[model samples]
Target: MNLSGVFYLGWRYLVRNRIKTLLLVAAFSLVWLLPSGLALVVSKIESQLRVRAAGTPLLLGQAGSPLELVFNGLYFTKPGIATFSFGETEAIDESGLATVIPLYARFSVGGGGGGKYRIIGTTLDYFDFRGLELREGRGLIDLGECVVGSKFADANGIGPGDAIISSPETLFDLAGVYPLKMHVVGVLSPSGSPDDQAIFVDLKTTWIIEGLGHGHEDAEKLGNDARLPVSAEDRAAAGETGGEIRLNASVVQFNEVTDENADDFHFHGELSDYPVMAAIVVPTDAKGQAILKGRYGRPGGLQLVAPSEEMDELFATVFSVQDLVLGLLGATGVGTLAIGALVFLLSNRLRRAEFRHLLHLGAAPGAVRALILFEACFVVLSSLVLSVVGLLAIDRFAPVLVRSFFG
Candidate 1:
């Protein structure tokens, strides 16, 4: 019996029953693709999480979940995590054991239907620590100035000289936490990390958004209508018992800082007492890292953690869950293959009359067996090819999908 002739006859039979052939191919392809596709996505997520976590040596934040601190500091996520006083960072810096870079990422710009972008309040040290470079304009030099990430700038079509406004924490902010308009001074180069989606600004700029600091018009320039009544005793303490003190709605609080009024901005409280969501601690040497770790080991108010270790623990749990899911998928795939085999067996049984007629018309028994084998191989091989093509498409798009999701 000619092997090519057997294959050609089998192909013709399959083409005659094209719907069954297509269904079997699709089912078998899914059986192979599901588990493999999931594994690829998990691998991509693990790599993306590990890259930034490994780069950061340590994270300091309010005593809570170590994972939350890691996400907040490294990825600018977990915006609702508790914050520690900026004084804690100052104290850590004074120890001379590590370089402290404070991060205040509680605020965001745009929301509702506009899409929210994280406003990362950090020092110049953060840029250096992350090895970020500017692609346009210059670094932040004044209040309300910002440097946007590459992804954010590109998505919004914003560059130097454009502006971004902070989104209010709530619609009914009774404490007067209004949105602040910030000038975009620069855009960072793409780093393929979470920083690519953040908006970097001075720490004080975040404070201004929180109502901890503000700029206002000079009180003396306000007219009498804007001024509120002042007590005589209060006026006497000011060494001015003569004119009414302007201390009310008459004085306009600036929502945006310009070069002329930048100097007028001031904080309501001590700079050290301001809130920071987390801080990145970079030690000078191994010994310094040990010392800093030991110092914060007995923490009550604050906690020091290794981001890499936290990530390991997180992925450990994720992998355990992934293994369980993959096992389930494997079992399902086996069941699918069994059903496919049953379908082939039944199809052969239904074609028994045809096979018997071929045998009567001078065909050998071995030829009939070969025809069945060819049909089975065709289905299996076609499914395998389709599975491989699907995996390749997923591999190509996984990174972009993961980045967009995380960002």
Candidate 2:
């Protein structure tokens, strides 16, 4: 018989038992989706992580845990860790082995429409180093002005000229730490990294939040002006004003920094000793990285670590878990295939009378066998197509699905 004739007969048999064909296809498709879908998700996470790690040549921090520091630096997940100082970055920069960028990520805020996002404090080099481009408006140039990530901006309906308020780290603090309002200056283009979920600001901006820096109208200038009420704590923060203390309480401490008052923002003591959670080090060469690593690889808390190596270590554990799951899945797949085979065999046995009648009616035995083979091939091929299509769909949609559910 011609190929088309054989296909027609096989298709007729499948359609005659359409319910059985549908069940078998559904079963096998699910079997294929589980393992393949999980693998695709893991691979997507690993690829994104490696890309972030590869961009930073090395990290220097007062690292009690290397993994914690690396993840906090790259993924912006862990923030309540020991902090070094800007002095470290200055030291590395002076060493001439690499260019160091300080990162201070200790707080988060509620953006427009109540979407939560992290507030990252770093220099303009952070944008250039990360290769982030502005999708709208301009980059952060002044303290208290922030450039939001595309994901955050889109999710919260934030655009240039909108504002976000920092969420207080604690509800109760005797210190005069108040929630500051930050003006959104720009929206960053999506980069498919953790940065896409963060708000970038000048390093001084976070210091202002931390009370280490402040900019306000001179309390001294507000002499004898019966203005807004000023508390004692606000008065103390206002500094020495040699006159009748009738300063505007709002001007006593800067809750917001603007271009007009940017110069007024000053840090007490040496900036070199200012707290920085970590420093991203980009060395000129492999030798420079090795040398810096050797210099800071001390027995004390301070240490230098390679982010890519730390990421590898992290995924080693992930791969172990993946392997165990895949092993169990493989066993389950085998059991399922064996059951499917048994069902096929029993089904064939039940059709023996039909085959015998075909043989009796001048149909050759070989022709009956060929028909059986064709039916079996048709079932297997249909199942295979269903499995492949399901896998492709899962692979394509897995990242977006995961982001929607988890992120």
Candidate 3:
């Protein structure tokens, strides 16, 4: 019996029933691919999350879910997490045990395609802590000036000197949170982190966007048309000994902060009372970290957590679910392989008459057996190749998918 001839005969048979062959290959490929692909994606997400979490020593925020605080501080996610007064950051800073970098990431800027990127209000210390470098221009300096991340700048075609407007909290926002146009002063180098997908601005600029600060024409300069009627009782309540002028809705409030009106922008209340979503706490040493943690150990309105520990707890639960899913997939894969084997057995039975015809033509029984074995090998090898290819594709694209999903 010619081995080459047997392989040729098997190949021709598979080609003649190409639909069945393709279906079997596809089913087998999926059986091998699903579990492996899932594990690859989960591992990628875990590494990414753990690396970022490990870099930050401690995260301080209002008492809430530790996972939510970690996500907000590290990834600029969970924007709706409870916020604490900026004075909390001040207290942490005054402790001298650690350096506190405040973060206010509640607002977002919308892209033309309807996607939104976080607006991270932070200080120059944040750049140093993250080791971020500017790819183009400079860092945040003045009011309404911003520095965009490389990914954001590339996706939106933004660069130094370009401007972006904050998206209003809602279409019908009655809270007076108007969109503020901000000038892009620089673009950050690609860091392959969440920072690469954010827009960084001065903390005060975000407050302006929040309606806590504003700039407008001087009330004293406004004409009678822009002045609200003030009754004698109102004037007495204001402690006005003489004529007093009050500006009304007709007075124009500056939406964009320019050098001309920058000085006019002011907050209505104390800066210490301003809201901060979270703070990244960096200790001088291990001892300092322990001391700081111990100080916040007691129950209070604020909580300090070690991000790495929080991540460990999160992945503990995640791994349990992952194991359960893998078990189900393993069972499914076994069932699929059994069905594939059954198909081959029934196909061989269906080709019994053809095998007999081959024997009459002087082909040995061993040659017929070899032909059947060759076909089975081809299907299994083809499916294995497809599964390997699918895993590689998952490895390549899983990070992107995970980042987008988490963000």
Candidate 4:
């Protein structure tokens, strides 16, 4: 029996039955792609999340879901269930064991193409802590001024000297909720994390948006003896007593913070009482983390957790999902094999006349069997190659796909 002759005959038969060959290739490729592709994608997502979590030592937030806190702190995706007092930051700073960085991520800015990026209210220390460099202009030097990330700037075609107006959190009460325009002073270098998708501004900027801070003319300066031209309703609305001072239509909200009115931006209450979404705590040493955890681990209003540990907890759930997906894929693969076998047996039956003619021509039975086996081998080899190529393509696009799905 000439092995090359048998292989050639097998290849020629498959080519003649092109539709069946294509179907078999697709089925078998799916059998390989499902399980392998799933594992590859999960691993990529887990690796990316873990890498981001690794840089963040600990997340401190109001007592709530640990997953939500970690995701919000690391990814800037989750809206905090509750907010912790800025006093917590003061206390942590005074502790001397850890440095706490406050995060306020409550607003979003929608650019062209309906792409909305989170507006992160933090401080200059956040840049220093993350080792972020200004790619274009200066850092955020004043309130209501922002430093955009490289990806965000590129996506929006925005650069230094441009402005970003925050989207209104709600549209029903237009008067109460005003859109703030922030000055774009700089763009950050690519950091390969959620930070690259954010617009960073001073925490005071968020406070102003929240109605916790404002700028206005002193009502005391406008005495009762002075004749006021404004109506009583307008005066009362803009008055500093039972309502917000800057309320009426004439009370123009400072859309952009600049040198002219930056001094006028003042908080209504003590800075310590202001809210922060979460705190990123970096302990001085191993002992410091242990100590900080022990201090805050008690039943309390706030919780402190290591992001890496929270991620491990998350992966446990992910593994359970992976197992379920693999089980389904395994069942599907078994069905594919059964269908493949049926197709093979049916093809042989259909070609019985051809086989009978070959046999009458003095072709050996063993040679016929070798031809069948070679065809099966070819199908398996082709499927393997196609699956490998498909998996590689998926891996190459995994980052963008994951960001689109999760972010």
Candidate 5:
């Protein structure tokens, strides 16, 4: 085959009808980018969910539905009952069964416009158990401090000392809402999981912000036993008269009180009356977990959950169908590309005369055949290049796409 003749015919074919070439590039690029981009997003979401679920053992919440608690607590995607008492958690640990870690999630991060960011309420052990590292200062230590995930920090322009606000009770609803501001005590290193888009704070703070940790609006009146609507001074006086003065529900948490009154004060509520969302248990041993599960089944305030089992079932049902549809769309794309190939094959028929003329001008049949092959090669290669370039641009501007569709 003559290389010079091939180049000449390829150049002629490309230059003769620029519009036709551009249309071919545009059509193939669309087909390439659509499937590729969807595949990219699906892969990302699946990978992120798996990463987030790796270390967790079980999630215990209300008995209404297992899937709701799993989604709400783990993925932060479902809304359901939000109270599992501290007493219930204690029973699991005391029953010589599972080592429980409580999860009481009831908030969201500030709006950076990508759905509601996950705001998880947990203990210090959560960071350790989940294998998360501190990015800047330190993890949540005091009640009011919070930690932001890397994506949360980067997207919202947050850092140490920056303020993170608790979004409303409703994820998408914003009516009669009072903002609760939490200070950024630390930033967490990115784990490429949902944590990167989550806000972590002490469980106490989560309850406190939502008026759940302790109920009454006024802390001054919290210590009072009079549920009959008495003020602080009256309650304090009543405490003196009421003898033995059991702690009121409103006043579960107190600080800086004297050591003498410490037992009677500061976090002094019957564990049963206190509200909780859910408990995450890490079983001390397999035998212990089995015994613990039997005990937990009877508790009124809590229910034990197997996070992994429920998650797998839910995702399998939902994503399996999604995978099927995506597979069909991908197949359709292949068929369309097949048709594009057929179109190119037929288009070559029009150039047969030209190739014959080249062959007549002392050109070998192999040279003319190579020129035809090069022209076809140009169509496929140019379309693929354009497609790659467009998808890369989409990846680079992903934040914009997220905001437009989800925010």
Candidate 6:
């Protein structure tokens, strides 16, 4: 068989029936990329979620939807679990199972794309716990200061000293309480995790936004311009009765405080009046987590769920459908391959006269056979490459589709 003869014959065999060749390639490409693309997307999302959830030992939250609670506390996506008491938060921290970083993620910031980069009111330890770093600006240093993740900063075109305003937590209904406006003093570097898509503020800042804490009291009404820290002692010294607004906005318009005048400037609220969505807990590992789960998973008590386990279950449920679809696609791809094979086989048989003429002129049977194989392979491979390119384009836009359909 002459190599040159094989090349000549292969080109003729494939290009001769242009329409059939093109259709076969198209079918092959779709068959090749559909399942692979779906698998790639699912795997990517799962891996990202799992990586973020790794250090998390447990999620402690209000007795509500376990999925929502986990999403809020762990991913900072859901509206969030209720705030655990200082006592409850402390016990979990002292649980000796896993070092706990109390997370209170309920407040929203306006101007940040997707609402304040998912504001998380947590302690300084939370940053270290998450392995996040400072890229351009420092971490949260003061109560009013905030550390925005790189993506948050990039999206908002904001940097240090660029303030972020707090919006009411719930946009769905007015039933949710209003969180006060907060500031963004710092921004963080990208951690390549969900943290990269978040904004961080101090626990006190969250308390302030939740109306659990406030800034200053109206001085003229109190008959003193002296700075007053609203500690237990200060409250006692002032002989203040009824209630005091924990936050005193430097930006509050009115200054006077009195029965007649006090209602104008200072905003007042009780600590317990504020609602916190959830807290994150840490147990040692899977076994310790199981033990902890047994304690909280009782019939009518607070629910404790492992996010990874729940996420896995969720992924499994969704993928079961995907698996079925992929199986059908694979079968169809195989069928397409069979049909294409038949087409080429018939084409080869039809070419016998041409082959015989060539053979008479010195073309070998081996060359003819090789020509047939080359044409088939070229069709399959071309299809596969085109399919892959199409799949990548689909992936680029898949998130929007996923949100549109599933969200």
Candidate 2 Cα errors over 4 Å, as ranges: 1-13, 111-116, 170-176, 215-252, 259-266, 285-287, 353-364, 398-407
Q: Please provide, for model 2 over 273-321, each residue's C-alpha lDDT reduced to its tens digit, 9 standing for 90 to 100.
A: 8899988999978898889878888789689998899989999999999
Name the candidate that leads on TM-score.
Answer: 3
Predicted candidate 6 versus true structure: per-residue lDDT over 1-407, tens digit per residue: 67776887678767777888888888888788878988877876666567656656677776868778777776677763455554565665677655556677766667432464577778787777777788876766555667887877887798876766777645553433344544556667766666766778877667666544544435555533343357777778878762764433333432211234323432345433444566567666777667677878886546777778878887888799889989998898889778878887887788889878877988677876787778888898898789878878877866544432222
For residues 339-377, write the lDDT of model 4, one tens digit per residue: 899989998898899898878988899989998999898
The per-model lDDT (C-alpha) reads 0.89, 0.80, 0.90, 0.84, 0.68, 0.67
lDDT assessment of candidate 1: 0.89
Q: Please identify which of the two predictions, 5 or 6, would achieve the higher TM-score against the true structure.
A: 6
Off by over 4 Å in 5: 26-41, 79-82, 111-118, 138-141, 154-165, 168-178, 213-271, 293-303, 383-407
Write out the backbone clash pairs for model 2: none
lDDT per residue, candidate 1, 1-407, as tens digits?
87887888898999999999999999999999999999999999888888888899999998989998998888776899998899999987998889999999998877821336899999999999999999999998999999999999999999999998988877787887678999999999999888889999999999998889998877787776778777788778988857656677546678999999998899976899899999999998899999988888885878999999998999999999999999999999999999999999999999999999998988889999999998888888899999999999989999888887665
By lDDT, is 2 or 6 better?
A: 2
What TM value does model 4 have?
0.89
Per-prediction TM-score = 0.94, 0.81, 0.96, 0.89, 0.70, 0.71
- Please report, as a residue range, the 10-residue window in candidate 1 with the lowest summed lDDT: 108-117
Total backbone collisions, model 2: 0
**Best-first order by TM-score:** 3, 1, 4, 2, 6, 5
Model 3's alpha-carbon lDDT is 0.90
**Candidate 1 deviant stretches above 4 angstroms:** 112-115, 233-246
CA shift at 278, candidate 6, in angstroms? 2.5
Error of 4 at 39 (Å): 0.9
Model 5 whole-model lDDT (C-alpha atoms): 0.68
Best by lDDT: 3
